[model samples]
Target: MPNKKLTDVEKLAIVQEIEGGHIGINAAVRKFGFSKSTLMKWRNRYRLYGMEGLAIRTCNRSYSAELKLQAVMDYFRGELSQYQIIDKYKISSRTQLADWIKKYNGHSSLRAYNGGKTAMTKGRSTTWQERLDIVLHCLANGQDYSQAADQFKVSYQQVYGWVKKYEAGGPEALRDGRGRKKAPEELTEADQQKLAMRKLEYEVERLRAENVFLKKLQEFQRGRR
Candidate 1:
C-alpha cells in the first residue's frame, strides 16, 4: 500500500508540536489520525533529514494480475501443477490460480484487453431458440413473464418478449427466430415429446460439464458429448 501523501513542512510542524515542552505526543494523536509509532518515525526522520522528513512510501506487498494469470495458464498446459505455479510465480494466493484455470481453460493465461479502444462486438446476439425453451417452460406452468424474469434475473422486456414470440409461433417461436409471424405447430404429442427430450438431453450434458469442473483440479471439458 502507498503512504498517504504528506508535505515536508507539515511533518516538520508535527515534529515540533510533538516535541513542544508543554504538550506530549498522545494529545496530538487525538487531534490527528497519526499513531504514536508514526509520530516517532516523524521525530526520527526530522532529526536526521531536517525539513525533508515526509515523502511518499510503500509497504512490501504487490499483487500482479498478469503474472498470476500467466502462471495459471502454464499450469493448465501441463507445464506446472497448481502448487508448482504458485511457487514459481510468487503468486499471492493458490486459489487465484485455481479460479483462473476454472474460468478460462487449462491454459488460463492473461490476455491484455485494449478495452476502451476496442470497438463494440457485432453479430453475437443471444440465441432465440434458447429463449423459447425457457419461455415455453414458464408459459406451460402458467407463470407470468415478470415472475420468470425475477426467477432468472433477466430484464422484463426480454421475458415478455420470449412470451410474445412463443405465443405467436407456438414451439417454433423458440428458435433462431424468424420474422414476427407465427409458425405452425404441426407436430403431434409424440413430436412435442421429442422436442422436450432434446432440451432435456442437452441439459444433461451441460450439468455433466459443470460437474467435471467443480469436482477437482482438472482441465475443463465443456460442451455436450
Candidate 2:
C-alpha cells in the first residue's frame, strides 16, 4: 500500500495467508494493494526470522565497517546472491546492501554507518562568512548535508538552506543582507588582508574536495570496466 503503515499483526496475517496457500501472490497483490516485490519481501523475511524480521524499524540501524566488509567479501565469493547475503546478515534492505557493494567495488572506504534523523527544527545563528564556508564544505564533500551539519555543529536544515541559497545566487546570497555591508573600497588594509587570506584558505579546501571527487569518479569508472 502507498504510504500505508501495516501493523505487525496485519503483516503476519498477509504473509500467513500467502504461505498457507489461502491466497496467491498475485491475488494478495490485487487485494492488499501492495506491489508483488513488497509482498515477497515480507514473506521472505517472515520465513527467515519469523516475527522479528517482520517488525517495523523504529530507528535507523547502524552497521559496523567490519560487518560491511564481510558482507562485501561474501558477495564477491559468489556463494550467495545479494538477497541471500542480506538475509544472512539481517540487513535492512537490498538498497543498503547494494550501496555497500558499489562502494566496495569502486574501491571506496567502507566506514561504519552512523547516520539518521540529524536534522533540527530550529537552526543556530551563523555569520555570513560561516554560512559560505559551510556551504562550500558541504558541496566539496559530495553535498552531504548531515555530515556538514554535524561537523559545524549547525542544524542540517541550516546547512541545506545555505547550500541552496549559495547555488541559486552565489556567495553574496549567503549574506544576511538585512544590514548594511561594507563595500570592498571601505575595507581597511588589515581587513582586506584577512579577507584575502580567508579566500586563499577556502580555495585550498575546494581544491582538496575536487581532488577527492575526481578520485572517487575514477574509482567508479574503473569498477564499471
Candidate 3:
C-alpha cells in the first residue's frame, strides 16, 4: 500500500518473462499481487497486439464496450470459447465477459426494458447492472444463486437466467430485459382451483424455516440451559 505502481516497462518485463516461462505466474502473483487471471490478461493482450496491448490501460482503449460486446457475441454463437475470447481480447477475467453479455441481451430487444424508449420499459425493472452486482455480490459473499436469490428478493430462476445470459452475451444479457413484467405461470383456472386448497406449500416452507431457526436457537439455548 506504499503508493506502489507498476510501470509499463515493469509490467511488460514481468509479463514477458511469465509468458516466456522464465518465471512462474504464481511467483509473480505472490511477489506482486499478480494472479493467473492477471497473467492471462497481460498475455492475451501481448499475444494479440504485443507490447502495445499491455501498455498502461487508459479509459480510451481499455474499456471498449464495442470490443467487449463483440467478444460476447462471438462466444454465444460458438465462434469462440470464453477462454478464447478472453485470450484473444487480452481480457484478464470473466467479469468483463459477464457484463458485456448482459448488456448485449438488453439491447437486442425492441421493448423499453431493453434500456430505451419502448413499451417494455417501465417499473423497477431488473438490469444487467443490477444483475451483475447481485451475481458478483453472491460470488464474493460465497453464496449460491438460490441462497442469493432469497436474499435479493428475486427468483432463483431469474438469477440462473441472468447467469446464463451473461455467459452467452456478457453484461448485455442482463440489460436485454427492460422493465417487462414476468409472464404468469401457465396454470389454468382449473389448476388454480385445484391448488387453492393446498396450504401445504406455504405451510411447508414456513415450517421448514422455523424448524431451522428453532434448531439453531435450541443449540444456543442448550449452552446456557
State TM-scores per candidate: 0.26, 0.45, 0.40
- Clashing pairs in model 2? none
Compose the digit string of candidate 2's lDDT tens values, residues 1-225. 778889888999999999999999999999999999899888877877799878997775777765676676678668999889988988877778888778766656566758423233236789887887788778867787767877887755577778887787766677786876555576688866866676677678878878888999999999999
Query: Clashing residue pairs in candidate 1, if any?
Result: 73-108, 129-175
Off by over 4 Å in 1: 1-125, 177-192, 196-225
Order by TM-score, highest first: 2, 3, 1
lDDT per residue for candidate 3 within 1-225, as digits (tens), equals 224666778878888788778878788777677667766677676777787777786553444433454465567668778878887776655676676566546653222222332211012357555786665545444435645565665644466566666566554346665674333254466645544433345356556766888999999999997
Best by TM-score: 2
Query: Which 10 consecutive residues of model 2 have the lowest summed lDDT?
Result: 113-122
Worst 10 residues of 3 by lDDT: 113-122
* Candidate 3 overall lDDT versus native: 0.59
